[model samples]
Target: MTSDPDTLWRRCAHLGRVLLPLVDQEPGRKADRHENLRTWGIDTVVGERLMEIFAALAAHAVVIDSSVPTAQFDALPVRTVAEAATSKRDFELLAGLPDSFADVRDEQAVQLFRLSAYEGGQASRRLFQLSREVRHSLIVLAEHPLLPCPTCADVLRRATEANLPK
Candidate 1:
């Protein structure tokens, strides 16, 4: 679809910021407690946000790309974390976490820290992959002629009119 590059960039500035900071830098402070907290925040929260953004990207792409019928788009499978999880459990016992530096050294605290860090890394990687996919889909859409079908055009039109992030 033909789009004004300037307008598109403006519309996507928020998501642009996200893609900007995702440069492949050295993972910082490998053992710092605060670093664990940061990773955890990114994994549990930023990860979820990225998934939403990715879905929006896919929706927009599917709406514009005529090669794939819109009917098939709904049936396309999207992988989620739950699908990757091994099992589900309801825990009756929840452990209280450490509050200070010294407490953080305890076995439970260390394990929790490691677990959070691991999960965060996984999420960050997933986010990176999703970003690449969304960007690629948008690029393909931009290079192609706008969908000529009225239904597809209307779907695309409503999406753009909503002023949702690209």
Candidate 2:
């Protein structure tokens, strides 16, 4: 028997709650953690979860737009306000994303992931410098007041702990 939309939605929400924290973990451990998530069949679950969140948000927008009378809608600008709020929420969610979860909205994470990969397996001076730069970017993004993405904040803390003088 096929699952109802509400059942599927709840599953997605549960998966997101579980996976998002893992995704917010240490950057250095991200590749390995992602591999484990994939092996445990959680990676696809998380991706599907994120998609469900987005779909629900879109449906809410549609419903709000439809509910408004056309003449009053134009005067109230409800649609525009809703779109702007959704856009900001989307950006905040993306700003919190981990390096392993690359999407169209996650360009910064992708760039940092590539930089870290390029510096791999070689204990050169440049590797340390590159790591520092990546960490700095993560911290700045995490602390950004406007968005203040909690995932970024978590990762930034992890990166700081990892890079501290030993």
Candidate 3:
């Protein structure tokens, strides 16, 4: 059975939504936050992989909310605080960030690049492992697919079409 990239992407999106209740719970409130993955029967490595996939999806959401241009998805440039403070930087600021997030700034920059590509149709192992987990999620959805929200589907479709093979 041949699987296309779009199918995999849609599956990842669905799994992300399914895992949201688990991942979105406030870490402070959930005593067994760590164990939720285990209790839910997700293995350690698979759980970690799901987290990574969620991160990529969250990153894409951030990029879209910021109104990042589709053309810029391929070459997302990073900007420093100093650069951002100065009016010279043309990069868009990702909101809701803490002032003390400087340490993870570089990591955030790399994430921006990866998420942008994923949102734009390009998938990568370094950014988000496009492995069996992603495939399995899609297969599950394929068995019983749901209609995607129009806006979300449109964005994902545009991104996939823009990034996928011609």
Candidate 4:
């Protein structure tokens, strides 16, 4: 059965909701409560988690609804979602940060919602990578002729709770 753009978008949001908590794990007994993720490549746990989320989205995109062609979606060029990108102001409100939205956006607010696997590059490189994935997927959803279905907007609602400061 072919699913429409709206349904596909909802599925992506659901996938994001499922993987959101993994991005923010509780500390181990000895580890600091607020630990930083190392810059280790996809071999590490952090990297693996990010890849897992992407993989989940890919699998769901093709199988959840037949409207999206696997090859086409996979080939979408990832890039920043400038106009449709999640606003920095929303990030600040959700994270309850004292700093200005611009400060957080400049620092890496995008990375909070989407995890990146790329290794070292220029500053804020990972943010750019995450934005690429987001933008690419959004394009797929917007361009594809999707079918209508019940949505999982609740997943997005729940994700707001996990929003934390960088």
Candidate 5:
């Protein structure tokens, strides 16, 4: 979508919900968790889990009135969301998001996703890359449009309590 600063939040939030989990899991597991288990990119376990979530969202979004986009959604490359142009626009909008309504405009969560896959320039992604479960919990505080609320860190823990594995 061509982002407008006023309505840019929806795009940023949508991207945050969609991409943060993937970016966080781009590396199979965190270095702290398994210092020895250093997989550079997605592995079977992470890939399968992501596919499961993607499939579930695609299949069941219609069941409830949700924003999972059963019909009107982009078929563009995943990298499109991380494009420098869009990311720059989204990044600027975050500061103007109605921060008073923390429930709606969570700047941190959006930035966690937007900066994680920064393109065309060097951006520091240290904070978003959490080293511990507690820190990860902070990122998941806001419920995402595409994914359910209170998400746990894929690097540290998976939500076993959920009905389906994510």
Candidate 6:
């Protein structure tokens, strides 16, 4: 099937790629803005937010790219994090984060950014591979041909289930 221009997987890939360079000296961001975060620095909770975002995005990429029709049936695609509804609450957990950054002192904001950058780097370095492996099992389980993969349905399910709003 011809992919829609605005699928969640596509949005995730686009956003991830944009944020990818923040974790490194890369192409996405302009040098100075990137420098702004780099010049500020120590890191994980914040790094972890982007990590959850990226992880969900990655899982979406896999299942969608896997071309498994059954898997695709379970995916949810919405424009903004506010509208996103999934079993994994990671995206929504950080729902207010961006606004929080806007209100906080630059120092605090940078710290949050730094932590996010650190986790993003960790994810890139594969330091988080073991957890991904654990998640992989859920994806496998969801492949039963009848039911949807809740894991893929909500990539951040395990990571943020605890933090989900009551």
The lDDT per prediction is 0.33, 0.34, 0.35, 0.33, 0.30, 0.34
Runs of candidate 1 exceeding 4 Å displacement: 1-52, 55-119, 146-155, 158-166
Where does candidate 4 stray beyond 4 Å? Answer: 1-94, 97-123, 147-166
- Alpha-carbon shift of residue 27 in model 1 (angstroms): 38
Q: What is candidate 1's TM-score against the reference?
A: 0.24
* TM-score-sorted candidate list, best first: 6, 4, 5, 3, 1, 2
In model 1, which residue pairs have backbone atoms overlapping below 3 Å? none
Compared to the true structure, candidate 3 yields what TM-score? Answer: 0.24
lDDT of 5 by residue, 1-166 (tens): 2223333333333333433343344354334323321232434443333322222222122111223332222332222222222223323323333333233324343444345435423222221222122123223322333544322232113322232222
Deviation of model 5 at 53, angstroms: 19
lDDT of 2 by residue, 44-83 (tens): 4443343334332322233233453222321322223223
Compared with the true structure, the alpha-carbon lDDT of candidate 3 equals 0.35
Position 25, candidate 1: lDDT? 18
Model 6: residues with Cα > 4 Å off, grouped in runs:
10-42, 68-166
| True-vs-predicted CA distance for residue 16, candidate 4, Å | 1.0
**lDDT (tens digit, per residue) of candidate 6 on 14-101:** 3332222222222432343334334333133343343334443444434444454433523532222212312333222232222222
lDDT of 3 at 141: 27
Positional deviation of residue 52's Cα in model 3 after best superposition, in angstroms: 1.5
What does the lDDT come to for candidate 2?
0.34
Per-residue lDDT tens digits for candidate 3, residues 2-103, read 123233233323334333233223344223434554555555554544443443344333334445543333232211111222221112322322223222
Poorest 10 consecutive residues by lDDT, candidate 3: 76-85
- In the range 45-152, model 4's lDDT, one tens digit per residue, is 443344223423443333333444332333222121222232322222123222332333222422533323233344235434433443333343333233132122
Highest TM-score against the true fold, candidate: 6
Per-residue lDDT of 6 in model 3: 32
- Quote the positional error of residue 57 for candidate 4 in Å: 16
lDDT of 6: 0.34
